[model samples]
Structure formats: structure tokens, C-alpha cells
Target: MAFFRPGVSREAEVRHHADQEVGKSFGELLEKARGAEHELRRTQASRAGAAELRAAGLAFDRALTDALRAAEAAQRAAFGVKAYDDRIRRRKGVATPEGARWTAEVNKLRTLREENRLTGIARVPRPFAPAR
Candidate 1:
């Protein structure tokens, strides 16, 4: 026989909703991170400011910590640790480590493109000239 609590407290119910909201917020942050990554990839590192990249990196780190905290809180409310661990382990989605990896990917592309420009291996043949 399984022993069960008679009443599910309002606190538990509220926590469940909070967990869902937190997940959504985290997802939105991930989307922002992706956008930042796209912009960085498109921009040449020589032209991009280090300060902007640093801010983006910090935002991603903060979002990741927030997501982890929210997951832990949800597990607490659910009263199970194995299930939470299993879910995280099995998770396969856009919300993966792509957040951190994006920075490196963008930087790699920037480095390659910068090297090409320095070596005169650009796609364009010549600069356009204006009529006198």
C-alpha cells in the first residue's frame, strides 16, 4: 500500500506554476542569447567591441544559473531528486549547452575571417571607386 498525503498544499501547487513560468523565462533568455550569437557571428571581431561580447557572455551565464536554480526548486516542490536528475540528463533541446558554446563558435568564425582578410584572401576583387 502507498502512503499518500491527504491534501496537496497550495504552496506545492503555486510552486508548480512557478516552475513552469521559470522555464519559459529561461527559454526567452536562451533565445536572446542565440540572437546575440548570430549578431556576433555576422560581425567581424575587428569591428565588434569586446565590451559588448563580454556583456552577452555575462547574460548567458546569468540565465544558465537561473535555469539551474529553477530546476532545483521544481525538484524540491516535486519531492524527488532522481526524477529531476533523470529529466536533466535526458533533456535534448535548444536549451542545451549551446548557450555557452555559441560564444566560441562565433569567435572561431571571426578568427577565420580575420585571418583571410589579413592574408588578402577576400571574396571581393577590388574596392569600388566613385566618379570624380
Candidate 2:
């Protein structure tokens, strides 16, 4: 016999809608992240000023985080909490192919960030202020 909880169904329905929205956003977020990554690469190759490189890195970080969040949400929605947890445990936090790719990108980003931090070139001017 299933326990009767009137609120449970409503909560599940809301979650379903939220998941749908997240699924829809995954593609857009991924595209934004890709664009940010490209910009960061270009800025690095061009040996841009510290401010520009820092800005690009920050933008890429934000975009990548957003994309990863959306992807995780979609995966959880598709797999359910228990199954998703099991998969994550089995995979060691990389539950899907997209997750693996994102993880690689994150690793690369961290390496670049560390290199810049070591070189003292990741500093940025005040937000919305003119770069010196």
C-alpha cells in the first residue's frame, strides 16, 4: 500500500516542470560556455592584457558552471535521485558523457588559472571601472 501524501504529487509535478525547463536550458548554456571558452583561448593566444585575460577566464568559469549545473539537473531528472546517486557513485562523479567532457574542460581551466595566478597575471581592474 502506498502512503497517501497529497503534497507529494504536487511537489513531484513542480519538480517535473522545473526539470523540463532545465533540460531546455542545457543546450543554450553549453553553447554559451563553448563561446566563452573560445574567447578565453583567443585572449590567451593573443597575449592580451591581464585585465582582458582575467575577464575572459571569469566569463568562461561562469558559463561553464551554469552549463554544468543545467546538465546535472537534466541527468538527475532523467535518472531519479536514487539512480542518479548510484550512477554518480559508480562513475566517481562523472555520470554522463557530457559530464566527462565538462570535467576535462574544468581541469584545463584550472590549469590555466593556476598558471596565470602563479605568473601574477590574473588580476583584474575594478568591475565597471576603466582598465589601467
Candidate 3:
């Protein structure tokens, strides 16, 4: 005989990855990027000294690069989670609403990531990476 625990549903576990881990992390990173961009623009428009402007620009570039890298990681994780959910649905012959929502969310994140990558001017500073 087997007992089913309502608290330990597959959907709950999958939802944690889709919503809590990847989604929240990406959202925070996006917010940070936006803040950095706004600061850069403000500094530029304020007619600050060249040194101040340059410093602000550098800060913004670093923040944007970090955010983009984090977003890429989040996107990859989201894709993996979506694929896992799809596989589970296929194996169980069940289409979960949570899974559908997660797929849509993942697509939205992908779109945002692509748009940011295309429009952003900053490149990750390779010199900052740790040596192997």
C-alpha cells in the first residue's frame, strides 16, 4: 500500500524552480540594471565634470554587464526547468496550468534578455574574471 502526500506535489517542486529561483533572481537583476542605467543617464544630463561622468559611465557598464551575465544564467536555468516540466507532462500525460504559466514566463524572460543584449553597449570586462 502506498500513501499520497498532498504537500509533496510534483508541481510544487517544479514551481519553486520556475518562480522562486530563476524568476525572482532575474527580476532583481533586471531592476538593478535599470537603476544603473538611470544613474548613468542622470550623471550625463547633469553636466557633471568629465571625471564624474566617466566614473558613472564605468559603474553603469559594470553593473549592466553583471546583470546581463546573471540574466543569461537565469535564462538557461529557466529553459532547463521548462524542459523538465515538459518531459514530466509528457510522461504523466498531464498538462499542468503551472507548467503552461511557467513556459510563458520563460518566453517573456528570453525576449527581455535578447532585447537587452541587442540594445546594450557594454561588454563584460574580461580582465576582471578569475584566472583558471
Candidate 4:
């Protein structure tokens, strides 16, 4: 009896592709966030000795706020969560090893995806089952 399942491998391939796409998107978001942070820092440093201290201070504040907002937005997109007007209002922050709180949510999503894939495979009838 042939043990190889035709569609099972294809389904796995599709899942892998989806995982890659999600990973790529997450990487892009992180990169963008980092870039924004770098730009904000550069702008702040350039205004360190300027005569217009008040204007520079205001600009620095705005840039810092924007950078933080971008970071939070990127994090939300990576985790597939709804964007909120207030960043701190979304989730009650939890403590975790290595400061990795909110990872449980990510694990939950991955588990759901794996379960879906397994369910799809299970729905495929056996190819060479003995007579009932």
C-alpha cells in the first residue's frame, strides 16, 4: 500500500508559504519601525545646540511621539490586532521570561493554524483502508 499522501504535502506547502508571508510582513514592519526611530534620534541630536530651543523642543517631542506610535503600530500589525487610539489601553501588560509578555497570544495563533492544517489532513479519506 502506498503510504504517500498526495494532497497532504501540498497542503503543508501552502501552510509553509503562508507562514513565510507572515514572517516577511513582520520583518518589514520591524524594519520600518527601526528606521523611524533612527530618523527621530537623528533629528533630535541635530537640534541639540540650536538657538530656537523652544521650537526644537516641540519638534523633538512630536518626533518622539511619532516614533513611539510607529513602534506600537508595527507591533500590533505583527500580532494581527486591532489598532487603538490609545496604545496603553489595548492589553494589560503581563510579565514573562526575558520580558516576552504577550507571547502567549502569538503561540495561540500558531496553535490555531496548526490545528486547522491537521483538521484539513484528517478530512482526507484514507487511500488504502481495509474493507469495513
Clashes of each: 0, 0, 0, 0
Encode model 1's per-residue lDDT on 1-132: one tens digit a residue.
999844645664676567655545545554654565455445435455555554544444444445445444433434322323345522432134542343344354445434433442223335689889
Q: Predictions ranked by TM-score, top down?
A: 2, 3, 1, 4
Poorest lDDT segment (10 consecutive residues) of candidate 4: 92-101
For residues 1-132, write the lDDT of model 4, one tens digit per residue. Answer: 879632424544454445445444544444554454455446456654333443433444444344444433333433332212223423422232311333543454345335433431222234796788
Q: Which scores better on TM-score, 1 or 4?
A: 1
Output the worst ten-in-a-row residue range by lDDT, candidate 3. 89-98
Q: Estimate each model's TM-score.
A: 0.37, 0.58, 0.44, 0.28
* Candidate 3: stretches off by over 4 Å: 1-23, 81-132
- Worst 10-residue lDDT window, candidate 1: 75-84
Model 1, residue 107: C-alpha shift (Å): 23
The segments of candidate 2 whose C-alpha lies over 4 angstroms from its true place after superposition are 1-8, 81-121, 125-132
- State, as a TM-score between 0 and 1, how close model 4 is to the true structure: 0.28
Which candidate has the highest lDDT of all?
Answer: 2
lDDT: the better of candidates 3 and 4: 3
For each candidate in the order shown, give its overall lDDT on alpha carbons. Answer: 0.45, 0.65, 0.55, 0.41
Model 2, 74-118: lDDT tens digits are 654554433332544436545567546655654654564455445
RMSD of each: 13.9, 7.0, 8.7, 25.1
